[model samples]
Target: MKRKLWLGAGLSAAASALAGIAAYAAHRLSGPTAALKRETLFAFTPFETGVDWEEVRFNSVDGLQIRAWWLGRPESKRVVIGCHGHRGRKDELLGIGSGLWRAGMNVLIFDFRGRGESDDSICSLAYHEVGDLHGAIKYVEARLPEAQIGVIGYSMGAAVSLLGSADQPAVKAVVADSSFAEMANLVDFALANRRLPPRPLRALADQITAQRYGYRFEAVRPIEALIRYGQRPLLVIHCTGDTVIPVVDAYDLYAAAQGPKELWIVEDMPHCGAYFADRPAYVKRVAEFFERYL
Candidate 1:
């Protein structure tokens, strides 16, 4: 009887520990929710001037309403679809859009569903966000048929654009900035950075994501996507001081790409701040790259 009692107790303890790990993982993934709220609430504080902004909305394949802005000179022949990072809306992309616009490219900046004015409240990371990119691409193709299309995506948007471009042939060239190699790696990095146990958190996050989205986070590996669909020219820009997602991920992506690619690492710039860190250099490189490729 005592042996049986101990065995049951051990199983109970193991189950409780597993539950705890899962909870931690879910908490880490939940970080974006609050961040999104903060960004939306303070959306008007930044970008006081430059570029004309117009509110626009379109329907995603899943029927979600996506919100965006058409910035700069609408008559420009060269066009760029700018995808904002997680928790960021089209307004946040104004700085980059203005630069691209001044470089003589029309910029279309949009917010993914569940962000800004778009419908939905949950982000499936890039797994479902790719659909948003497809919708944006279709919009661009229909409206700007004669224009050469290019894409600039940051973080989560970068991952979606990369995957979406792999599926769509119209994307002439791509600029991916501060992107993660995979959703699982991003979660693991977050947990480790917070001084938490990574394995348990990752396992839990995988279970939760699969239960909620019907797919595994590992299945959305951007590095693998880059390797598989490296036929188009890619420009990878990363900041050496990025603490959220390591700069090494950008290098890994650059190295894994099979086709023509360029990697630019901005010294001491944090996260997506590379553009602001060296505006002139950023504009020059981006213009030169698209001029050559597109």
Candidate 2:
């Protein structure tokens, strides 16, 4: 009887340990997976070969050095700053940048910290990235004080733009694609999609980010920013088939935003592929929107 009781206790302890390991693994894998695959997305063979581009670097307010490219006609006065998504470098944005350049707009594309050539290996999503966007805007302002400025951001980049636009009044127009309404919602979606149990682990991740970054993950709400300061010409685009970040978040952002705002729901496109799926339509719609606003 004594031997049997000891065997049962050992089995119970082993089971508990296994369960803990599974939970930790699931949390790490699902919480914040990088969406961009550099080898898969950055092949330059398909794009225009001889486009004008100059490598540039600048300093952020926090002293982080950022690397980017300036594309299009060098003497063009109209400019649009394009912010790439989390895990994505500026190279992935060249397709859209090319279109904007053809439309007579100079384009600047850069990576957020930790993603591309930028300094630092930590990303606080948009909570810290907004500061980077502010730094980029300041860089543009110093060079083109009299030029009208527009911004286009994707996913995490979009959230950063929404938050940054609230603080910077010089931005003439804003475009966000497949953006999340809140950072916590993104965490929750990622967890659920991976079929991971999300009780203590999710809470722990939030706690860790807050303790390290001095801001709660839940507090980085882009919908709230839209409600408060989405006054300029805004274009919110999302795809119905965006499994990574739900389309509903874009709807929520559009509903909260006031003034000259429009929401475009692209059918059958996944995540940020709306532009690639229909290049002509995407360019036409975006160009028309910017023409009306900027």
Per residue, candidate 1 scores C-alpha lDDT tens digits across 100-185 of 87787777888887677787655767777788888888887787787788888998888877887886778889999898988788
**Each prediction's number of clashing residue pairs:** 0, 0
Pairs of colliding residues, candidate 2: none
Number of colliding residue pairs in model 1: 0
Cα deviation of 137, candidate 2, in Å: 0.5
Identify the candidate with maximal lDDT: 1
Candidate 1 Cα outliers beyond 4 Å, as residue runs: 1-18, 27-42, 45-47, 72-74
Q: Which regions of candidate 2 are displaced past 4 Å?
A: 1-49, 212-214
Cα-based TM-score, every candidate: 0.87, 0.84
lDDT of each: 0.79, 0.77
Q: TM-score of predicted model 1?
A: 0.87
